[model samples]
Target: MTKRSSRLDDAARAGWLYYVAGNTQDQIAVKLGVSRQSAQRLVSLARSEGLVRVQIDHPIANCLELADALRDRFKLKFVDVVPTDPGSESTITGVAESASAEMERWLRREQPVLIAVGTGRTLKAAVELLPRMDCRQHRVVSLTGNIAPDGSAAYYNVVFTMSDSVNVRSFPMPLPVIATTSSEREMLHAQAMIRPTLALADKAEVTFVGIGDFSNDAPLYVDGFITAAELKALQKAGAVGEIVGWSFDSEGKMIRDITNDRVASAPIPPRETSLVIAAAKGPRKLPGIRGAIHGGLINALITDEDTAAKLLG
Candidate 1:
């Protein structure tokens, strides 16, 4: 083999060992008989040269049909449905894999695009699976604050992850997920540090958000952003789902109740101008996903086959 092709082979091997086997750079260097820096460069070369691709390539017929039907029903801009493992009721892995596929498409674009992201467990999973790339042309901004209720940054926030994964410019909202009161929320929103990020989020052409269900294990409540009294109050007002802390009722109407009055999340972009894509699934999020679709909080969806079927049903 030529020297160039031999180098490509080494790079590919390095990538497989690092990404697939979850090996550290030192481990890869030891296995490949190369210096640690060389191993890291080899892995980066593999990804940049297109020798590494991580995706769920299967296009099951039922999933296709469901995706098509969902797109038609909601007038969505895009949709991808993947098969879920029979053993798993929640398809977090499958949804994350599919979301990473779509996110990669945007990250590969040459022209600059403003991409906004919301925080959640599934979104965090998606960012973790993304193959590292150099996409400094695009900008990523967060729709929700990175701060959790307990004063620590929320571990599930995806903006920092996206920045690290793609080497893109990232704007993170350093405020709390939700303020303790409407006046406190206003004060945070007025802060100069976070307003630009929120404004940029409003103009982002592509948005990645997570649909949160108002269930017994609701993310906001579980994360301590909302109290039990707040939860019961919102449910009493017909709230069923939330996107970026903005709660909505089952009929897909944004509720202007207690939690929403104090939410610090950026406003959902206009659906006509932006592609608000979300990755969500499982029985818990079914109501919220459906509500998001109906209310125009999101215009695109990436989910599992079973979830899609139930959404259409």
Candidate 2:
């Protein structure tokens, strides 16, 4: 190698060794007989000249554009995009984990009531990765009714898990999300026992929800909350996706239907709360995800890279 190429190669090797070996600049510099600043500068030069080739195996591409598209379309304050690597569960898990880290940073600000909507496998993944919420005065509310039997072990378990994580109270809605008839819904809402929780939902400061597909395999259907007939009806009615059971069209516009009315009645309006949705998956969720962006229901989003690329494209 020529003199220039030889020095560049040494710098490239040194930089790779430092990065992979988890050594600090100082350590690399001392070991290489150079100043820490010189080591840092050389690493940059190596990278710029393609002397150092770093392979990051990202699952998805255009994550930044996806984040920008989501923010622009939804008018959100922030959007986190994670890469999708179908072959790697660990990569998928890392995306979810990174989203949780970003959420932690956002929550550091003063927000009164943080609402969590229960729907979809992605939401579950995000929640599992969510760091322990440790603000005593702040509260976390359940955005939707539980899918399990009322007061059942599973219901309480989910509620307690969320409550304990934030070290705050859970505004539990102790009622079925969907009722047989409008009259039944009215009666349930009239009851003193369920009124307080519902009221708290109405006053939520921040809401976290998941978007859903109309497929039977969708998270809501698998949760045992909706029947196959309901899913079919939603699809027939041109419903592309749903949030907290409220169906919307491909543009995220609310589809005026009995089911939608029921869903809207069950939860507070997005306009009245700081709405955030944990969005993920690709192609499958695009219609519903796009609907959310159009409907002004979601003001913040946490999503994976593959889904982001689709949205931006």
Candidate 3:
């Protein structure tokens, strides 16, 4: 036999023994009557020569099962469940990483798409984790106001982060999250610059947002976006959660209160967007997440395994 053919046969044998038979290098060396170094070289040759190809089947069976269950139960278009420790902070981090990956995938699509984003901690975290990419073809628009009462950009604003990360043009709603009154909100929405951005949001192919719970410890309240009295009023109005700064009741129906009218962001119906992805995870967020799902506010979700189980329950 030719020398080259003999080497190929030895490589195949070493690869089968090491990979398929699950034998150690030492065992392969002894069984093949070769040194350990030679056995290792043969396996490497097998890989390089395409005699053996390694395929890593990710052991994400549990996560896939949960994701499938969530999709089926909520009739959602997509669902991703990430593993995490037994805590809200860890859960948030896990979900953010997963959501970031999902966003990267969408941004990499060949067809240019508009992405509408909302403000909140979880969404902000996801944007922070997003890898830098030059996706100038895709445009990003804010689904909520960028400014705060103190004349500073809202802490959780996603426009700047997304724009910088993707190096894309962004349309920010240059307004407060909540105007002083419904009339003022109307005036702000009427501005030519603001109107165009809001209009673009309505046409967004995908929307990413963080669901906010109505509890006392809610991020909105803790972040000083809303007063204690305002929070109490929302709770009294049966508010369970919010999406894109629009408060909704336990059934996910928009709560028509002063706050709703004063909200500066244009409200896009959940079903109108091709994809509404929400990044959130925690015990406190359970009710809001559930309400959002039931209300069809979000067709896709990125959350941790613990939250997924609670949601299934």
lDDT of candidates 1 onward, in order = 0.87, 0.64, 0.83
Candidate 3: regions farther than 4 A off: 1-59
Off by over 4 Å in 1: 1-53
Tens-place lDDT per residue, model 1, 1-313, is: 6999999999999999999999998999999999999999999999887668766567789889999999999899899988878877564878887787788889889999899888898888778768789988999999898998889988888988776667998899898888888999899999898788888988999988888888878888998889999999888888898888899998789888588888998888778888999899987888888888887878999998878989988
For TM-score, the strongest prediction is 1
Pairs that collide, model 2: 82-305, 252-291
Q: What does candidate 3's lDDT look like per residue over 53-172, in tens digits?
A: 443346477788999999999999889888757534554767776777778887898889888888888788778766668888888888888888788988899888776567877888
* Residue pairs clashing, model 1: none
**Candidate 2 on 1-313: residue-level lDDT in tens?**
5998878876886778676787788888888888989888877776665444343456344677787777886678768777667765432354445544554555566665455554445555555555566766566666566645344433322345555455665666666666666677788788997777667666666566667787657655676556778778778878888777777888777777647655523463455455565555566777787777777777777767767767766
State TM-scores per candidate.
0.84, 0.70, 0.79
Q: After superposition, how far is residue 216 of candidate 1 from its true place, in Å?
A: 0.8
Highest lDDT model number? 1
For candidate 1, the per-residue lDDT at 153 reads 82
| Weakest lDDT window of 10 consecutive positions for candidate 1 | 49-58
Task: Give the count of colliding residue pairs in each prediction.
Answer: 0, 2, 0
Any residue pairs clashing in model 3, and if so which?
none
Error of 1 at 23 (Å): 17
